[model samples]
Target: MAGSSLMKSRFESFICDANESVAIQLVCSDNELDNEPHNHAIKEFNPEFSHQLFGDNESIFGYSDLRVKLYYSSAKLNCFLSIGFTDKVTKDETNGIEADDVVDTIRQKLSLKLCSSMDEFRSLLSKESQFIPYGKLMDSFSIDWKTDEKQTKRHFEIYSADILVPGFDAYHQRMQTFLWWLIDAASYIDADDERWQYFVVYEKRSPNGLSNGHLHSDAHNTYCFVGYATVYRYYAYPQRIRPRISQFLVLPPFQKCGLGTRLLHTIYDFYVTDTAVFDITVEDPSDNFTRVRDFVDSKNCQKLNAFSVDKLKLGWNEDMATEAQTRLKINKRQARRVYEILRFRCTDRSNADEYKAFRLGVKQRLNAPNQKQILDYQKLEKLKKFPEQELAFIRQTTIPALEVRLDLLDKQYKELEEEYQHIVERLAES
Candidate 1:
């Protein structure tokens, strides 16, 4: 449900491409361009016409057909906009359209000056800008990453729907558009959904702070948008709520800086304290997300008394199930999975006796569904007794299949362990 306040602004119709595949990227800042005496605009919107356009690292990749790049300033004064189209799409054979026509269409939509030169672009920005600042944030925190034995701190903030209300806020809508470029399959959600929550990470810096450093302003609480996640609350049985993480993204600039982990842990902290929360879940998590979640969950589950090395060896008991569900709000199935992982970590695979016990334990669970089939085969066929049927099953189906399954499971465990190790290493560093 969109609120009454959602209205079109100056940059509303900037995207001119009819193809949904065309990506629009924005690099914006809130800092006033007071020092800059001139504005900047795109001289050439053609990508392949020039060698290595937008510099080496800034080039857009993976799109064979088309791409639209936008660069603009969101300062209090002197707003500037630039538009560019990739060369592959400019070819009539490839795109079935004229590149110049597409660029013209975008220019018409943005209603800004076109620049053939840097000086001209800068001159256009010298004029007064109509940039409206994004709204203030509610809660914030800082996470630090170490570089060359030095710690660098990043500031992040959390926002609720009420704080960002009345649903149609300009920043909220702008962010939805911005997210579409970076997040695959990104779409706008109902801001009116009371169960939805948002978290944003920003690269904040004060006016006097170093370029891209933390801003020292108490008066202006708006931080430069870095990355964000959207979560929805689901009604669980027995008067509890399950918060399902929906879309998660950390911009390329802020990625690999350990902010994703911080953001996820922050969400967990938010829900874990709620009296009505049952457990947390994620919706159709990607491979990257699965790794992050597994790492976070394994760490959290390890602290529970029921998940200790000894308790884990005792197998998945009610204590493990009950404590994980009651205290950590983890579901029974997930709790059991976590228990197995922790137990595997404690096992010394080099020892035959210990390793055999571990394999037997896992195999018993793996073969559980086939137990009745083996019994039925023996009883109905009457060719052999229970022992003979079991032996035949083991030779024909069970052992061979178990070998393949175990190999796959071991590989998965090893991969998960590697991912978990990375998180733990970062946690220790941070």
Candidate 2:
């Protein structure tokens, strides 16, 4: 028992949490790279995943103060990976459990050139000036930036699908390597596929530090990635294409600063303008992304005549969905959601009749699926003649069912109203 306890305690010293052990930094300038990367990691953050790179335990044994520093040149995303530890448990000290192959495992996940040393990565970073963004400049805007001391307007640009340009896929891959560090379920998309498209946001970074205004000149603009979204244009059978957002992330250094919202708004504009596109969709969006999407869609719909205060109070209408689809490319399901949000914004909460009408309108839409199911049942051949016995049975079943559904509807409506209220509150703030 004494020996067993000693062995367990000894192995515990070897165990290191992979999530904490790994560190990522976006190196924004040459000065940052010239110095030791370990100390000056600009906005250091840990990856959401360690298992995908480290293994089942999501830990690296045999090391203490184990920090796997992964640095990248902010503009070019030139990768520099270094595995450091204060101590390493050796074969002589352990009872067979081995240290995880930390370096090799991470290298396999990234296809880009992995510079093993700071000097080598900095050598590649020197050529950043030649790295022009591949796609047509889609949009550029300046935002007010603030820190502990002062405030200045920072500039950013969004580019449409870089993979479409010949020979530029390498740069796109370098950019995507950041996703693995941020997105929990991140995976590479087939850049070769025509169906996959990308929208990337790059900050016109000043090598000195984030400085004011459009780069002293467009000719002198040095870009670093802020965030990006992957869109897959799926074929809608006979004609038209539906673009679904597969991945989205505004790096930890830049989130909560409206960069995600800006990127999403720009992508929406990209699809809404494309005549071949049907409607925008998302593949398993996180709750955070859904809120951003809701805000953007609702904001856009509010500008349309069909979703105006007058129309929203009149309740949900086909014209609301129709205009949203035709003018903005919002699908009916999403349009209905946008309608509810906009209606909540316009709802007269103080008036009893107005509030009741609003609830009834929302409840009607919520009950739509159940109503359709009943209509579908009535279409059965045996029930078509409306037999008295069957009618009686349906009535009997429906009374309780309706009661259950009503209770459910109220609960659902309350939840929806709460969500819409949050979105509306955000809309006001934004």
Candidate 3:
């Protein structure tokens, strides 16, 4: 007990030192290390150095000078620390150490045995009990689904924004670090703001009922972290609430497992079921997110009576638009997009007559503005100095202009058709 306390004090002191750290490394007890002692040849410390020593999402892909190695037990909370020169600057003279001597000069520090495993490490770092469920009860709020790769079940849960602010805990703080790794120009959240909501996906595991040689039946179930998203609820004019997804991330390990689509669908389900929500929205969605949303929205709309293939053939109408907004919480513009994509999915591309009909249907929507321009030109043609020649010139320029616009629209339709085809294939699997 005395030794554990001493280790905790040492670890805290090391963290408080505010030394010029370059990078940090973590290893389990099973990891091998050289027996050579750490040399302390270079001692200059910079207090303001925070050069994202961890790689993009903790991969150590970027440049970093100093390195901190964390050694922990494989399944226990035991951890030891050491400061070393990263491989990037092992020989750089700006750091005031000879290339080969840097590794020899590194120093070892405090060792801590607080929690067990990486999951427990995150639990300790979280400030709110709701965000970090370890050692806490949270059986009622979880939703589970199976992953495509491992075929293993994963769970997701929603939490109010209050749990992330003011005095954020260690686990939440650590998880927040992922934003820097995954997002561009990312910043930490204002925990005091009640407008944010979080959705987290994790792997649920049963507890072994044993802790440090003691058995406790009430030990909370373990939730191995996967990914999470942040959402902000805005009060639109009138009685509408617009929930914008501020951030969405799926860790690299879980990518391509259909988890992203599942997460998106789950979030939609949450909002669609709410009585106060006006329409769902997204904040600066990436191209990848836009595609996923296209698929999810299209699939859901297909189940509605208003978006049937027969209705889709008749094209987007007030009834289809209204049902999408009221039943699916989709905005009008996006609802129209989904309607077109679904319509293209049912199009018979191999049949020349059917294909021509599909093309004409899309072209008609694209021609509306061009048709208006032609009418305006016709009205002004009679007033020109040489009405006959001016009218001829206008016809010459306008017809080709319309053709160019149609060409561009055709390209857009083809690209959208390909995307819709992919979505349809995925839907078939589901």
Candidate 4:
């Protein structure tokens, strides 16, 4: 027992949280690449996940004060990975287990070319100006974050292009590596597939006239890659396509400035006019992305005649779905969701009758799967003795589970309301 305890204690000493140990930075530079006159790293953050490279435990067993510096040039997205540590637990002392080969693991997982020397990295950084954003500029906007010296309302531009764009596959490789660190369950896309499209966000150094959704050549302007999204064009039956957002990510330093919302709006603008597109959809969105999506969808739905105050009061109508589909290119499922969001936006919680009606309507949608389960059971009975059998089934089975589902339903409703309230708050600010 004493040996076992001592071994465990030694093992604990080596275990380092991979997420915390890894440091990522966006290195920004102007004409002076030889010497960054100031701190060259404009933005620095750690990974949201590391288990894919560091094993399921997300720990690296044998490093102290580990600093995995993975820096990328802001303009070109060129990568440089450097792993450093104050101490390493060698296998000789540990009695058997070897320390993880950090660089080897990251090289395998990220599939990025690592810089062998600082000179090589700076060589790539020197040529950063030659790197231009791929594809056509689709939209542009500015965000204002205050600094001690000035209001840093930086200019940003979003571009949409096919994966086939010359040199884009290479660019995508470096950009998609960010997904491994930030997006959960993230994986790379096959750029060779013609159906995949990319929309990228970049921060342009220029100050004004960004609202035009177009950028003219300004030698003075240096474009820095910010965030990006990937979309897949799935074939809808009988000649239409459904464009689903496969992945969306805004780098940590750039988030919470409405860049994501603007990015989504640009994506919508790209497809809404295309007759070939059936509807827009998202695949396995995380909670944060879902809220952003809901906000965009509800706001778009609000512009339609079907989602007017009176129409919304009427609640989830056929016209709402039709208008949302043909005009906005939103699918039925998302349209229904937008309807509920807009409905909840205008619902008067203070009035008992109005509130009860809204609650019951939402509950009906929430209970649909449970209702289907009951029907499924009924169907198994050969559809015989419908009224009596259903009553008996409800009494025997549902009566016990009803209390549980009711409690869940209330909880769900509360969550939904809170989410809607947040959307409404954003909407108001916009």
Best by the lDDT measure: 4
TM-score pick, better of 1 and 4: 4
lDDT of 1: 0.55
In the range 1-430, model 2's lDDT, one tens digit per residue, is: 6988988887798799888989888776567755564432357788777666767677887888898988888777888889888888877778565677778778878876788777888777778766677677888888887767678798889888657687568877887887776766778988888777788888885645564763566556677778888899898978999989998988887787788999998888888888898898898888889889999999888899998898788778899889999999999989998988888788789999988888898899889888886776666535568777877687566544777988999999999888899999999997
**Which prediction has more favorable lDDT, 3 or 4?**
4
Question: Each prediction's TM-score against the native?
Answer: 0.63, 0.87, 0.61, 0.91
Superposed by TM-score, candidate 2 places the C-alpha of residue 309 at a distance from the truth, in angstroms, of 1.4
In angstroms, how far off is 394's CA in candidate 4? 12
Name model 2 segments beyond 4 Å from true: 34-41, 55-57, 363-414
Model 3, which residues run further than 4 Å from truth?
1-161, 164-173, 207-220, 363-404
List, residue by residue over 1-430, the lDDT tens digit for candidate 4.
6988987887787789999989888876533334444432355799999877887888888887888888888877877788888888877888877888888888889898877876787878767656678999999777775545555556788998887789888888889999988987988888889999899999876322222333446664667788999999999999999999998999998888889999999999999999999898999989999889999998889999999999899878889889999999989988988898888888898999998999899999999988887777767566566677666766577534888889999999999889888988888887
**Model 3: ten consecutive residues of lowest lDDT:** 103-112
What does the lDDT come to for candidate 3? 0.57
lDDT of 3 by residue, 1-430 (tens): 6977875553333232223343332222121233442221111123122223322232222124545444322222233344554344332323343322222222211111234454655444332112344322222223233334333233343332335444333444445544543565566776457687766665433343112222223244443455667778899988879998888877654566666787787678768889899888888887788888888898899999999989888877988888998999898878887887788788888989877877777677767777887887767775665568777887787756756887888887787668778887877777
Residue-level lDDT for 162 in candidate 3: 35
lDDT of 1 by residue, 207-290 (tens): 343222455545543334556677888998879888888888765545676677777877777677798988777877777776
Clashing pairs in 4: none
lDDT per prediction? Answer: 0.55, 0.81, 0.57, 0.83
RMSD to true structure for each model, in Å: 11.7, 4.1, 12.8, 3.8
Span of ten consecutive residues with least summed lDDT in model 1 = 41-50
